[model samples]
Target: MSSSLEVVIAGGGSPGHVYPGLAIADALRARLPNVSILFAGTGRPLERHLVRAAGYNHMALPAKPAPHNPLEAVRFITDNALGFMAAAWMLREQHTSLVIGLGGYASASTVRAAVGRGIPTVLLEQNATTGRTTKWLSGMVESVCTGFKEVTPYLSPVAEVVHTGTPARPRFLKQYQQWQQQGEVVRRSREPRIVVLGGSGGAQTLNKHMPDVVSRLSEELKDWRVVHQTGEGQLQCTEDRYPSDTSQILTVSYIDELASLLFETDIVVCRAGGTTLAELALAGVPAVVVPFPDASENHQMANAEVYREAGACVVVDEWAAGDRLTDELTSKIRELAADHQRREDMSRAMRGLAHPDAADAIASRCCEILCGTDMRVAA
Candidate 1:
């Protein structure tokens, strides 16, 4: 393989899309030390921060989400056209060997540009119900790597579907390994913790309801504590929701190092984004998943259903719960917290579903497509 091989990872309307791409890039670098990796995406501050923090060059594109109404149609076309042209030029100028698409609106143009340029391309679909971008680009790409095997039927048959699972960051994988070795000793020394993750953008429903749910379990959770990551801008509001006896609950705007936090977590109450689910599985934390109703194609719910079927999580539909959201969440958390055996079973099930080597698997696949040989052995 050439030492100057360049790979552009295109994705990132949200952290869910970006993190997987970063994991893949990390894996690629490990397998091919000289490989150049670039991220192409919208100029969202969050996206830029994450990529730059991971020590990668990012190229901002004029990509916009697909229009929801007729009024947005023209702007969406104009922006994406510019993005497509920019992506095409980037691929040619960088002499890109492979273009990996992590599905989102931001990735559509770049992957399309790669196909137009006849470049080796792979799409990563991180949901049981594949996103629209992945479905549209499936037939054009060389392969569609999926987080869930259930997503295969949604993709085009012309594309090779590889179940690589969701790629978690290296730190999470390392922590998972360490936990496997000494988790029992460590866990026994610490108080049981229930973590509430509202994602990078705080879920309003979770932020409003979780504190109350935790408070309801005060007696049952006498020995336990709750740590809530309320995302940015909602810290004060979420913090205020807790009772005067705040010893049992801690609310923060964000968690800078979630992998470390998960190392000590006994249970998690979070939304069912593919990346979050993958992380929870890796940490082997029993989860009470609340799927975002507004997720693209209800993909979060679909992702949650897979885990629920495997006995890895308890799924709660916030939309369906309506006024009873607090009641339902309290019930689930109460059940999980009280049943030590059940939590252990769920944790085991979660670990059983984890793909610890997902990043490497995806990296190997990309290399095989590029070099026509197994790069794992070559590396």
Candidate 2:
């Protein structure tokens, strides 16, 4: 291994793109303690906060999304051209050994620069359907690490596709191992709990409608508790919807320890972000997946379909449900909550899909590529 080796992980714009990159970073640092890791991404507040809070240095690039119309196309070119120049400079200045792209427009410029410089590059695709950036750069990168095997057909035939599963954060991985050792024991003694997640950015539809959905299940949820993570700035509005007399439902802005919470949760009502679904699989939690309808290329729906086919979740299209969205969600929650045997079956199916060693697998691949020697890192 080269002592002077430094790597850049490029991706952002959302927590879905950033968290998996962080997980890979953690695994890389574990194997190479002295190597420098820098995160390159867009100048979004969420991206900046997450990287800095994880104690990694981050460089903000002038990247923007692909233009939708002719009017925006010119600006897109100007912004990304500047981004590509900045990325090339950063790669040269840092003496970058490897560049890992985490599949988003935010990562396009940096990865393109890396390939142009003939640097070793890898791309991580978290969706079942390949992202536009990943599809565009797939043939050029050294390897494309995928979360779902269904994504294989979408990538360039020349692209080296590795099904390493999705990399989850260290905390989640730790909890997942603990669950494995404990076996599949259902906790019936404690109060059954339901958790609602709207991703890092609160889902307006979920935040506005889920309170009512839970309220509708009042009779069935007499002994059950609900925890709603309403994202930032939406807590007050969410809290207002629940009845004041009952303390059964608790609303919070964010969950810092989601891995811990998932273990205690009976079921989840959430968006179908690839990273979130990967975590749910690790925890073996049954879910009522309400995929964000407007996700890029409807990728969230594609992600949910995999879990649905595996019998791990019930897919609910919020938009298709129309005015019956609340009723549909309520029905799914009620069904899952009432059937203990079914929940356990779904839990087992979910666990069957988990890749506990995903982070290590990806890091090992990166190490092998960097050193030109096959290597596996200890978890």
Top TM-score prediction, candidate number: 1
Q: What lDDT is reached at residue 319 by model 2?
A: 81
The reply for model 1, stretches above 4 Å from the true place, is 374-379
What are the lDDT scores of the predictions, listed in order? 0.89, 0.89
lDDT, residue 19, candidate 1: 92
> Positional deviation of 62 in candidate 2, in angstroms?
1.2
Clashing pairs in 1: none
Candidate 1's residue-wise lDDT over 1-379, tens digit each? 5688889999897898899999999888877888889999986999999999999999999998868898899999999999999999999999999999998889999999999999999999999997656777898888888999999888887779999999997789999889878866776588999999989888888999988887788889889988999989999988998887668788888888999888778899999999999999998899999999988789999999999999999999988999999999999999998898998899889999999988888988898887778344445
Error at 286, model 1, angstroms: 0.6
Give the least accurate 10-residue stretch of model 2, judged by summed lDDT.
370-379
Model 2 clash pairs are none
